[model samples]
Target: MSVLLEVQGVTKTFGGVVANQSVSIEVRAGEIAGLIGPNGSGKTTLFNSIVGAHAIDEGSIKFEGEEISTFRVPVIARKGMLRTFQQTRIYGEMTALENMRISAPEARVSALSLLGGFSSKTDTRGEELLEFVGLASKRFLRAGALSFGQQKLLEFAMALMSEPKLLLLDEPTAGINPTLINGLIDRLKQANKELGVTLLVIEHNMRVIMNLAERITCLAHGEVLASGTPDEVRNDPRVVDAYLGAG
Candidate 1:
């Protein structure tokens, strides 16, 4: 498969602290790539730089063969890329379906906040996506009232509403109940297989990452520690010492 996203020699700093230094990785089209690291390993910083949430001090970021290191978040997003947060970002007062509809690129952010209005087409697609994410029954509930896991499901559905080509997920299973994880994993794989979306997921749950990712990359102290197939990365001494065993 072709490379969908390429990040090379990237570095970032805040004040004098180096958050990421000379990091490099790639995500291929139609594959689930895992990113794992210990706390403060610069995993999130790398995601920020790739998605244009933060400016990198150096190196290149390419999506679908074009350099995007200089692009801002919206520009990158418009190019069919989107990122989900570790903490679900949904309007607390909005219903699950409402949250999904307003996330469309053409939807006016503030207008939706006040009116909660959506087109019939957007509503239909939103409802379908909600059902796909296992929240169809809760479509009428306010987002804030949902459990953390349910809120995350809603957030995932919202991102799907955009039909993103490359979706960057940050710690997707962090606080969710373990029992619900398999269901979420199945949804992610279905999205990748049926919808043809490329996923770059950051996850700490060893079992989840091991089973979900076709390839795995491990990071430590702001640098690439290991990268390969799931078993290869999982068995690497550096990875085990730095993250796996610790987890």
Candidate 2:
């Protein structure tokens, strides 16, 4: 598989604190890659840097062989790359369908236009995605009224509405129950396989990531400690001592 997203010697700092230090990794096209680390290990910081949630202190981020380290979120998103937060970012007062419509790449042109009305194409896609995430019945319900797991599903669908080429997901199963997590995992796999979207996921749930990702990269103390296939990373003594052991 050819490389789709690449991060080389990336670093980020907050005041005196070094959140990420010279990290490098790659995600190939049409593959699921996992990022894992202990608490405060700069997992989310790396995600933010990749998505342009903020600027990096150093290094390069490339998507589809193009430099994007300096690009803003909207710019990167328009290039068919997008990210979902650990916390679901949905409009609470709006219906799920409304949230989906507003999340479209075109909706950023004018909030008023989105609020006023959407074309039939947008409406049809919104409802289809809602059903895709198994939230068809809740499409008309207020976003905030949905359960945490449901909210995450809604956020996933919203991201899908943009037809991204690569998606960076931050702890997708974080707050979900075991049963829901299984369902979510299935949906995530479906999204990757059926929709042909590439995924780079940050997750603390070992079982989930092991099953979901084709390759895994482990970070500790703001640096990559190990990276390989699931079994290789899982058995690596360094990874075990640094992250899996502590977990």
- Global Cα RMSD, each model: 2.8, 2.1
TM-score of each: 0.93, 0.94
* Model 2, position 140: C-alpha lDDT score: 92
lDDT of 1 by residue, 1-247 (tens): 9999999999999999999989999999999999999999999999999999989999999999999999999889989999999878889999887788778756634445646555788889999999999899999999999999999999898998988999999988889899999999999999999999999999999999999999998999999999999999988989988964565
| Model 1, position 222: C-alpha lDDT score | 94
Identify the candidate with maximal TM-score: 2
TM-score of 2: 0.94
Q: Model 2's lDDT to the true fold?
A: 0.92
| Model 2 lowest lDDT segment of ten | 108-117
What does the lDDT come to for candidate 1? Answer: 0.91
Instruction: Please list the residue runs of candidate 2 whose C-alpha ends up more than 4 Å from where it truly belongs after superposition.
Output: 108-117, 244-247
